[model samples]
Target: MADFVDREAIRHCLARLARGEDRRDAGLIRAAWWPDATFDYGVYSGDFAAYLDWVVPGAEAISNTQHVLGQSYIELAGDSAKAETHVISYHRVDMGAGDRDTCIGGRYLDTMARRDGEWRIADRVMLYDWYQDWGAAIDWAEGVMGYPFTAGHFPGRARGDFSATFFAAGQ
Candidate 1:
């Protein structure tokens, strides 16, 4: 047992999660967690896989997203450790005729365990202090990411009914 459990390893796990989430790659997302990892969101609670299923797709539907991690707190004991990372997130979504932008700040509390020299998150809980929703802040989402809104004109939009779709098969 060391005072520090290879801090870089913890950082790498966070990086992997952020990358996977940004790319909407489920496989990469899973690689960031332990098999029995548990997640407790404000309203969602279950394995990491289920949490990703709901959150990731919705993120993909958004225009732009940036998950930035700030300061961190980590403590190691034996083969297990605890970590907390401050986060600032920016997101933009289509609002039919236009679009909406949001900025949220939160912290991720994670329990890490090293098994066979691999670090994985065994449990994670999100602590969101507050969020500022800048409704439709950008006229064009700041970049051309093919936002569902703003077709050829402000009024012209793609006719696609929105519904909840989850990859239940874990594809």
Candidate 2:
């Protein structure tokens, strides 16, 4: 029972982290890490706060982003845990002529600890499995109905988007 609960808590933490990145919510992203946590992502390796500062703006620059989570394997020992989670992320970049889509397959190996009864990541290393990029064939914004799918109608991940309003309203 304890293992199950720990697994769930750790999974929730990971989910929150992913949602933060997808939604561009800095606070939510910050919540996933301890104050002195560390991170390594091949391209960058430093404190968690620095990682957040570096990643958030870059993510915001993209037109849209989505992170698809797969499986997580966790090992728990009392108030500490280690996990490896699989992920596939998609980013759309507008380049005037057309949009470029990048797909990345990776895994996050994390060391987590429970502090004050809350689980947060203490250290994380992101391993890249594969990556690919190509021009998008069809633009969703220019669908057959001629309506821009991302234009305010649907809630977005970024600040001031509908999701922020919806979440703020508590519905």
Top model number, TM-score: 2
TM-score of each: 0.74, 0.84
Give candidate 2's error at residue 27 in angstroms. 0.7
Q: Give the poorly placed runs of model 1, Cα more than 4 Å off.
A: 1-5, 59-61, 95-97, 137-171
The 10 consecutive residues of candidate 1 with the worst lDDT sum are 155-164
What is candidate 1's lDDT per residue for 1-171, written digit by digit as tens? 345447888888998887676656677788889978999978788987687776677544476666889988898877888999999987777656566778889999999999998888999999998798788644543335555454433321222212112234455
Q: In model 2, how large is the Cα lDDT of residue 116? A: 95
User: So what's the TM-score on candidate 1?
Assistant: 0.74
Listed per model in order, the count of residue pairs whose N, CA or C atoms clash below 3 Å is: 1, 0
Question: How far is 13's C-alpha from truth in model 1 (Å)?
Answer: 0.5
